[model samples]
Target: MPALTLSRGVADWPEQGYDGWVLLGMVTLSLLPVIRLFLQTLNAGSIEVAGVSLSFAAASESAAEAVRTATLTENLDTPEDMPLERTSLRSILRALRRAHDSEVTVVDLRQGQTWWETRLFILIAGAARRDRTQAIAFVGERNGTPGTFLGWAPPSRLLAAHLRSDPLLSAAHERARAKTAAWQLGQPLPNPHASVTPSVMLPWGTNQSLPPVENQTPDPAFAFELYLQQNLDRPSPESGRLVTIQRLRELYEVFLVTDSIDAQTPDDAWAEVVLTASPRRFFAVTKAGKFKALIPRDALVAALVTRLVRAEDSPS
Candidate 1:
């Protein structure tokens, strides 16, 4: 009902009572070309939007150049019979060990954890192999200084370690040990296998030659102690909070480790290993902090190994 004025020296329109809807439509149609031009400018590289100028093309080129310059390692050559899962685990461990003293971003993806979906930048102060598995002893870094030592093991291994130390299982374990000894000496096993009939074959066969069982179960406390002994020569922080192995295990149990995309490109070999292995859980050797890092879920496992390996291979 009121006369409408258009900006940019356009004449005021009072025709048709200056219908607001028509004016709105006309304004939107006029903006279509400007919107198209803005998008084209963005794709062309440098562009200003909302008073902020950005050089997307240059940023992309810089990232590509960084990837090109990164030091990369050749895929590990392993025996055909060796499981790729084990190989990938080994690769990750090797990378962490090599990347010691370097910083990395760790994101906690575990639901309901203290830092769930939080990212922390941690320095890999040190790493030690534990009990021949893919487990490692990690040193916590804070404010660029190493403070506490922690141990990490696979979930199953950690559970087994705890079960071995459980007071309730002591008596049962001892009795089982005695029975195992008796069986090794050709004694009959209990219950279902107690009365061996001619139809049923003995578990150890007629020769009673049972395969040797190697007890290499990882012990977190022992591993921590070993780590401490290894670092005995290093000076301890004058004042820092000491963390228990149990607490460390509890914290690490819920988290998975991966490399930040900014660190390195995901390794195809490592990706293949992950695809073949299909591991449901992973752990990182990192310090506790509020640092942040990101990696695609699919690239999670591959990135850590590849980045660390690249860091190690990279010339200082």
Candidate 2:
């Protein structure tokens, strides 16, 4: 009986030690998160916040000063039908680089505050090829903002009005335009989008299904394809002068009519506008101007116009 009692006691002692070890482990696990938090707080405290300014700030100021020094007419007057000799962009880039005394080269200058780097070359080429005029703005991803501007069009008249209405993008445009050389006005250059001016506006329509003709015309289908490809940034239909669903239906037959095209379905809405004829061609009739069927690329004409209007109307 004594031997049995001793054996039972020994077993009980082992159980107690095992329980103590489990308890100690639980305590350690509970405190670990708190210790981690304390260390993070200490590290955060070591970083000092200072009110540092960018060197570009001074460059921006100087650039603005140069622009303001001239009279409004002299400064604002842009030339008409100016064709790009080399890239007019080069002059502006050089000017900005000189003023800033930094490596600040011209990224894509499509709209206000928003610009692009070299990554957007294909997009720029596509935009330039599609537009005959009023395609000045460069659509590029820059500084986390997606925007537009008059890349080829002179910053005058209707273009100015569009800029005034769009507060967000227009402000950036104002800054960029101010920094640019005054001579860019009348030069024929690449336009990113249409301007409000009737002379420069190019309308895009989805009405590609025009009546059949004897000779086949080269479809401008690539225009819309290019437009869609470059416009990865999902712009809001209500952001600026966006075409309403009803208006779009009435005007063009094709569209990606959603707040964000990049987002997935059931939110996705895309449609194509084909001509009434066989192997349907694309054409859109607009009050601005006729985007001929020879260039199926004209399908994006209205869309680009709408995008420009939206950018011009949006506030910073």
Candidate 3:
């Protein structure tokens, strides 16, 4: 009876065609890895603050000059809900207007559409110095919202550490500082954001899913990667381990924006960059690149850093 039972069980296996089922299961398992890889590739997206692609093309010499003039003339530490001395503001508006021969137009990159008739407010703060770093906090939406974006000049080493881990931001901050510094130094600002990197603006139209001309133009993406590497290559004040992409993504929204989706895509105009420095934060934007200068993102940050240090050294 025992032998009969064993033979019956074995006989049922063939009757059920267990080998066929086994082969089918193996095939499914074998394809899973490939399927997963394909899905990952398909879902690839972009990373940009407030929906604007962080690229060199976004930077313009005239735009940077305009920003420099505005920053120099405007009150960098003006409080919200209060009107500052009109002299500087009017002068800034005049210079910017004459420089570009038009009214100032603030473009909300997050909305993907131009805010043609609305007014926008942006603030600039100072950054920490090596010997006496200030303690500034960033306000607004840290997760991804857009509101008063801020910039700061973190010491070079700290900036580099952030880069090895967070290439996108590191790239943005680096390029911004470099260009802005050049502008302040009376040197011609370069288009550092032009290096190719994947980015998707917020409020992107339905058709604006992946990067524009992604497959057709891979050079930009490669350029972005190179720009990021360059961030690491630069001299820094301190040294630390390189951060993984995942870790950097965690700190992605550190820019501290006030809201999200201020504009929409394809037909949008205007681009804004925020600088966050300890005890100080600021933002720079281009009214219209067609007739203006590139917003100096990095240079603004570095300037803020220097400003913050100077402020701290001054009497309270």
Candidate 4:
């Protein structure tokens, strides 16, 4: 509860002309929000300030007696919903701390709200910078309206598009993004189902898997790795570029991702490009630039081009 002080001898309310009504009006407005806050807390047994909801649920009496409180039950895994207006990183971090306890926190993102999406992007990224490792689950309605659950799984592109601007994560983001582009472009995407982008798009790269590789000489998909191993002693990523390759009167794109070898000085930013036929397929390119046996199977260089062109010409 709060109080508003009235100035004495003010021209707006001179002492002689003052009535109790004016004071009462000012007091009512001041106390209204406090009353609402108090009522909300009383009803929910939780304290909310600045849109972050913090609620503590005590362990069940029966469970307590058995001393079996190691992890929460699935039925009790309810996500604390955040307020729609200006959910701050501090608030999200607070909710995350609560989530480490018995409650999960869910940020409800409305459909097509670019403003909220951008804000959420910053929040998730900030969480990443802080090394927060919790799966961020968002609840979104279909077409921003009342609807049945189309299914629990949403499109991978839904997150990929939103997360494309991350310069820090572009290396990882590009892996799954390549798959998305391959599928949409009707290119040879051997591992479309093996997507880490949806989770990568969020702040959680909580799992690590060995990058797939081919050992045989001239595995064109790994031309970049071979070149790096041969030329550099200690290699590091520098920059990545996408190149359009046309052969036999057909055009295709390859991501010419680059890396810097060990350098002795600050000017050691010299870089070399690694060629990949698909997003995930990194092939080795020789000084001669020949990729005979290295090209991926079932993805014949020229035939695949036709599918890509057809996919592009198709109506959205």
Per-model TM-score on C-alpha atoms: 0.19, 0.16, 0.18, 0.20
Residue-level lDDT for 148 in candidate 4: 13
**lDDT, candidate 4, 68-109, per-residue tens:** 111211212332243322332333333334433321123333
Relative to the true structure, candidate 1 reaches a TM of 0.19
Q: How do the candidates rank by lDDT, highest first?
A: 1, 3, 4, 2
Best by TM-score: 4
Runs off by more than 4 Å, candidate 2 = 1-90, 93-134, 138-270, 273-316
Candidate 3 weakest ten by summed lDDT:
116-125
lDDT of 2 by residue, 185-233 (tens): 2233343544311111122311122111123321222322222222322
Give lDDT tens digits, candidate 3, residues 1-316: 3533465587753344565665577676776565445323323432243333332232333234434232222222333322332122222233223323221222222221211100111111012112122211121222355433332222332334445553444454556445333323342223355443333333322211112222243233123222332343344532222222223223333532322211221212222223112233223332221112223444433333333345456654
Residue 170's lDDT within candidate 3 is 44
How many residue pairs clash (N, CA or C atoms closer than 3 angstroms) in each of the candidate models, in the order given? Answer: 3, 52, 55, 11
lDDT of 2: 0.27
lDDT string for model 1 (40-150, tens) is 544444444344443322232333332211110222234433322234223333333343322222212121122100000011112221222222223344344432323
In model 3, which regions exceed 4 Å deviation? 1-65, 68-139, 142-151, 154-158, 163-213, 220-316
What does candidate 3 score on TM? Answer: 0.18
User: For this target, which candidate reaches the highest lDDT against the unseen true structure?
Assistant: 1
- Choose 1 or 3, whichever is better by lDDT: 1
C-alpha-based local distance difference test score of model 1 = 0.31
